[model samples]
Target chain A: MAETTAPAMAPARPALDETLLAALAAAAGDESGGLTRRLAAQVRYEAAETPSRVRHLWRFTDPARLLPMNLTAVTGAPGDVSHTLAPSVAGAAATIDLWPGLPPVVALSDDLPAGQLTVVSAGETAGSPALAADELFAALNEAAWNTGIGLAVADGARLPGPIHVRVHASAAASLPRLRLVVGRNAEAMLVEQHLDGGPETRVTGHTAITVGDGSRVRHAIVQVWGQGTNGHLSVSTKAGADADVLTVFGVFGGDEAKLEVRTDLAGKGSRSEIVGVTLVTGKQHGDVHTTHRHLAEHTSSRIDFKAVAAEHARSTYTGLIRIEDQAHHCEAYQENRNLLLSDRARADAIPELEIHNQEVSCSHGATIAPVDPEQLFYLASRGLEHGEAVSLVVGGFLENTMAKLPDDVRTMAEAFVGPRLAAIREGSA
Target chain B: MSDALLNPANPANVFACRNLHVFVKDGDQEKEIVRGVDLTVQRGQKHALMGPNGSGKSTLAAALMGHPSYRVEGEIWLNGERVDALEPHERARRGMFLSFQYPVAVPGVTVANFLRASLAARRGTEIPVRAFRQELNEAFATMGIDPSFITRYLNDGFSGGEKKKLEILQMLLLKPAFSLLDETDSGLDIDALKVVSDGINQASGPDNGLLLVTHYQRILNHVQPDVVHVFMSGRLVRTGGMELVTALEERGYDWLTDEAAVAEGSRT
Candidate 1:
């Protein structure tokens, strides 16, 4: 496939201030006219024409840069801001930002880069319709994304600790997109946490990650938006030969949340594992969808998801494991388990297998269950009160699934899921 | 009923069941399981209730322990207090213990924790861990049971003999004022039976009264009941001293019919 870049385009609204574009150009460190042109062609120019509720709201403003970092150049225009985010082996100034909002909002500066790892943190205030879309684009375009953390470590190069990026929204409405890139023969762990300020906040974000040959990356996203907050995440990963990728998506607190993760094993001898756990209650809805494409020979992938629903809550899971013709000798496995703690709770599981290669092995299974009365009575008879008995049994039930995780992964899983399950049990009681 | 036996001022008797009649629901009707029977165990006395299978000896013990399934039509007094209306745990709180013939297993809860919880429920205070452990270790040593058993799930994965020994261990820790040993020797070998009987004898004090429920004389030979009562047709037809246990052992329950007939004839 050829490396493609979009064309440059004029502004949709002539009156939209060119000063914002000038600031964005300055933030795009390269200052190359071709790069700026490439950034403009990919944007939805007419999106700025959406009807506005308030003129003071400034819904149709052009994409602007509020702050600039010197580490990487951004060639793209306001429409699609593209810059490189590379780890500073010698400790460089690593921060980036877009235009500040009309109203004062909590803004977090990008983190200082550590050995072979870089971090970016930001908060955006979004509003009705067009502002929401604009805020999403602004956050994505403002990242120091030049050459995008490009590095090709030698085979068997071990990257130490996780590269942590925190996307925080302190407004009633915000959309933040955090992106990351990894290199060949290098290993990296990335943790992203989505925290909200209020119930009315709405977030839509996308993270694009790529792994190089003989490298491994473990990525995790923990979403805890308050009541009425809607959280959406779209993640994409590409693995090379002998590369391993693991992703844990935990959804605990949200009015309604949908997490979609897609992984592509583009080379042979690669493995990708997707694991997720969700706890929802009080009319809450949780949706976890994963797509695994085995595009190379001798690649393998596995997906496991567990959810607990209570008090009229609903959970839906849709997963796909596909092995293409070129991916012969591939193995894929998928499983989903749901525990319903109340009669009104509901769970829906969808597992699909699409195999074009006859030499591949693939399997999928799902299960939904209510609390076992016999187990409850057994615990109660042993002098644990009814509540404690149920708690212990529930803990045991979830622990069985956790036993399959590695040490660090298991600790992360427990820290993310344990308190939420406990809270649900307490709320039901 | 004589006034002397019924008087609350009488301090000699620890438990008195007067004409106690128990019934069980058979299909849609309440069928009598324990006919009219008067039994008394004096303070510090250890007596045995021996009978054939289906003779309602266990029903009497259940009635004394306030089993919800057993409905009594008579009065039961424990230590001068009427206990016919109490619940099982309430009766247990009042220093009553019943060692089940078949104990239920509970997984994930250690035996020591269960014992401490039950003891706390009875004593209404937090027991010091050091004191509790000391007493538990002592009880285990006396009963010849391994100390590791206390750390396991209550009765879970335990053998029949181990379950029986655990029951005795619980009895020792709780120190009930009165205990009903229901076929404690049913599944035990001779050595286990001896160890269990010895544990019971060591735990039983001057203030604790016991009623042993069994079908055989094997346990009685080791425990040495102060009195023996033979139950038949849901009623006790004969009550006697140690000699009576020997008689029942020598001739079996066949002589009980002749002995009952002669007693009735002489009374007439």
Candidate 2:
């Protein structure tokens, strides 16, 4: 049995100042609209109580670790943001540059067809529904987001390639927000990456995605922060009738990180699939939580999450599926598998299901174990070296989930996970 | 070790083992499973080691292949090179292969990918994708396996017959100089048995040696053996031609065990 240690006392939660909130609201244009939303979010953030460790969502990770030590925000100078456009989507997609304490600058490609897509500052879309304020970090992001963007795709627009959004943290504390609205019968792929933060940087992010009826959306969030950086992210998605949504979440770099995803099947015959892959080595830590709520009849959802832990790294996964009484004839499946590559590496998995209707079919399973020796021996007997055999096994373990990603995203994931798997020694466990 | 045993007079001697003893750890005690034994197989020669259950026939084959669980104290030579000290993969790279009685399943790894990697490791270079795919397709046709199995995980959720056929398929790909088939025919049906036997025959040639370990004589009907050795109580007691297999089938193993006991008593 592994040794047990007493839990460390939680750090103090960072305070939110009304003066700073007002300043941020003023800098974000559309004073009448943005200020009202910011003030409401600030009130919600202050009114909410700190979550206790007893809550399953906050059980493995301490919320205080996600809070930045300093409360000051850093605003980048003009022209500090860099952007890249893939050739395939060069004509169809537009780029939006967001910086703290400045209005967003939108650049439309010359070949972009009129009325096909709308790229604008989030402050202009003030009538859009506000993000849920029950969570601490999400409310913090809503109240003090320094960088924000809103993207709207016209109905029946099919993008040739994925739109890329790269968020670079320029300071110790940063808040980023993104809102996406897909029109009916449209198809779009979005890739959001978090990068360029230092060891002590702490980032809080919130993303809200709304899909229209009979539409398909593929969204991927790849987080590759510095070795000692801390990140907290929340993603909430809602699907219309017959809409299909696929979300891929990849975590490769960070000292401490947490991601929470919630998908609501609000339309009849809608479907949602969520795939997550996390690789942690050394003393890094990763925690992921997902919830699928079926609100309409004939809705379905599937969640598959896998994590590989090496050295002394630790990973935690908790997934829940809830079927309401009105959600008759719904199907939900959740699976979480963890691979431990070292004797010191650790993994924890919790799968939960709640069904209020007898007509629903729901199943969930979780497994945590080290690599099988028989598997290694079998590969070795086929002439592969020990290192090569181990690499093959680990790669295969992640391939099932990674294969579901977009082509470019899958390549990026391999670039991040391949080297870490190669560095592991034979029989290190 | 005598010079004659180390360097056999016949240059065609493809595989030879001298006084091989295998021990497995059970808790804190070392349990001897394979008593000291000597055997030799020349090129184009097929040998069958017949024994009853719990007689350690599988242990000898595994120990000869350098399985990490067994403590082997003996010399195993393949193609005139000693390999007992090498790792299993190293031995495999040097033309040694073992078809396990119970093949393990590797989830998330496709059969095509595994075969490509194995071929690459054996040849010391990556095989071209197109050529590899063509070869895999041909092998699949010969093994009577569906081409769809190429994309399926290796042996995962495979039936008993399918697993056995895959083992033979691997043999056809690796083309080891010496192949030790441990109970390859145990769970195979009649049709699967014939197909696997045909695959084994196709892989065997004038330059390689074959050693089949089994407790049943059914598989021998498909793949004939040139030499048959009766194993009892972890030792090879009698070695002869095909007559031994027929005798064991008609008379069973009790008579052989009685004679072997008397012979051991007199020698001691």
Candidate 3:
């Protein structure tokens, strides 16, 4: 696969230093800098072998936990993210990009209805911290991230389009934290993209979404990285009474990519649809762990994840659906399908359900198998080469997951990941 | 075994196959499916190869089409050009087409998209959307097939008869110089058979060649063949005109097998 060439648009910024990260991650700042203290502690905790609460082969280890020194936090006015936002979505909505060398930049459209949309830094708004203090991975991200973007939509307000966030990982580790709050009866869409960084760039990203009563939110997160990068990304969403959330996760490519997502439906009549797809090639390892917890009465949840692993790559998926005791009339379903493209590729899926409510309905299914040979020959006999046929099958599998995304976001996602998919196929061939 | 079969080139031939043998691997063992086949199709000619079940007729067609699963061990000449070493798509690009007996389905791929891509690859240029749509609609209407099938997944969930019709629709749209139909009439009713025959006739003009492989003589009635050859046990036993097809319909393949047996006994 072609190693992603670092985007040349980055302007002159403070050069990255090796010792700077060691110093920032090693020091426990004063009590006034409590966030820094927590970050320092989290960095140290990452050095040791910390067992993952979720059991699997994707246990995290040896990854840089602290934000890199000189990480750009682009904030306010035109920023780097505005440039990367696809032209199709450029003028549709407010755009932002969190660069490693600048502060989190946010540019809201002035022509929109007043009080309809608002964006603030974590300190400016009284937004609830999504990650608990005990969740070390997410806690460190929340504490150390300098680009914590807080979004709020007014009650009964409908956004014209989606908020596009393009984050560029740097040579050093970056902790990106997001807090989104959709007000009552409001609707919004969020398209978050993770762009590739340098060969040594390590990224740890965390996002928390809160859907208000009777509100709807559709979030699509796509990860596109370099050949020598390490990534740990987690997204946790909460839905309120009568609220709906459709979230799609597309893990396009990386050297070592670990994605964990959780959706908690705590309000009555809340619904959640979670879909994801991953493309793993080379010797990369891609893992996705998702959990859907139905904690309220009359709530429903659906989870579908698909992965295509080729070359010596490996894909692991573990999903669980937990219905609490108080949640009656809950309906939940979880399905995982993996396509292994070669003999060297490997895939494993584990789906589980825990229903404490006796009167609930829940089911989980998983399938892990090689790509169908019959389909390959069929396409090949029609004049496509074997490689092209395999590539088409893999692409169709990935595109099926995009059906959950909005039309604009899906188009952008395809434009973003299509070339990377071609690279994956090339490497496998 | 014969000098005629060993000759690899026929300048006036649209497609010439010389001593072609195809083998496929069953588990770890190599099995020769098409023992040896020599065929030649001239311009504007239709040759029918009829045989019973398991006679390797379809295997020979697949081998000539350059299917990867079959290891071909003979020279293939198309329009006086050597092309046995080429891949299937290469053969297709050089104007060779084979209508599969059981065309495989490609889920999530629409027939319109598949045809557009195949046409583009075959012609080495992009076809405008409007032009492509017009061509597809015309072909669909000509085949008596529903236009909605164009948007449906390619051959996915298609009925047996529908799949056969779609294959002929592709053959009509592609218009290859040399076409091989392997049991194209397998799942067609009388009406569809007539439509498909009309489509075939439209393609078989003065420049293109057609070979219709079938176990029954029902299709031969509509699409008359210039030459009819009876193939038994992977070898061509007899060749004649339309009278041979009538004879086979009247007596079946047993007579040909019995004649072959007697000829073998006499040789011994």
User: How many residue pairs in model 2 have overlapping backbones?
Assistant: 0
- Candidate 1 lDDT by residue in tens digits, A1-429: 121322323323212123444443344232345234424422433233432323212211111211111122223222111211111112112223221121111222244234455332211112101112233333333322221211222334455445444344333334344445566788776666555435555454556666778888887776765577665556767788898999887777677676778888887899999888787878888877788999999898998888888778888787878788877899999999888888999888767788897998899999988876555433332233445555555555555456555455466556656665566546553
Q: Is the docking of candidate 2 incorrect, acceptable, medium or high quality?
A: medium
Q: For model 1, how does the per-residue alpha-carbon lDDT over B244-263 read when each residue is reduced to its tens digit?
A: 88787788887787776676
The lDDT ranking, best first, is 2, 3, 1
Model 1 CA deviation exceeding 4 Å by range: A1-115, A118-156, A213-216, A261-269, A272-275, A290-304, A319-335, A350-365, A402-428, B1-268
- Candidate 1 local Cα displacement, residue B260, angstroms: 17
Give the winner by TM-score: 1 or 3: 3
Give per-residue CA lDDT, model 2, range B1-268, as digits (tens). 3556456434678899888899999999999998888888888988999999999999998888888899998778888888888999999999899999999988888988899999999889999999998888888888999999989998999998999899999999888989999999998889999999999999999999889999888999988999899988889999998899999999999999999999899989
- TM-score of chain A as modeled in candidate 1: 0.69
Fraction of native A-B contacts kept, per candidate = 0.02, 0.69, 0.37
- lDDT scores in order: 0.65, 0.82, 0.74
TM-score of candidate 1 to 2 decimals: 0.57
Residue A84 of candidate 1: its Cα lDDT? 15
Judged by DockQ relative to the true structure, which candidate is superior, 2 or 3?
2
Docking quality (DockQ) for each candidate:
0.09, 0.73, 0.42
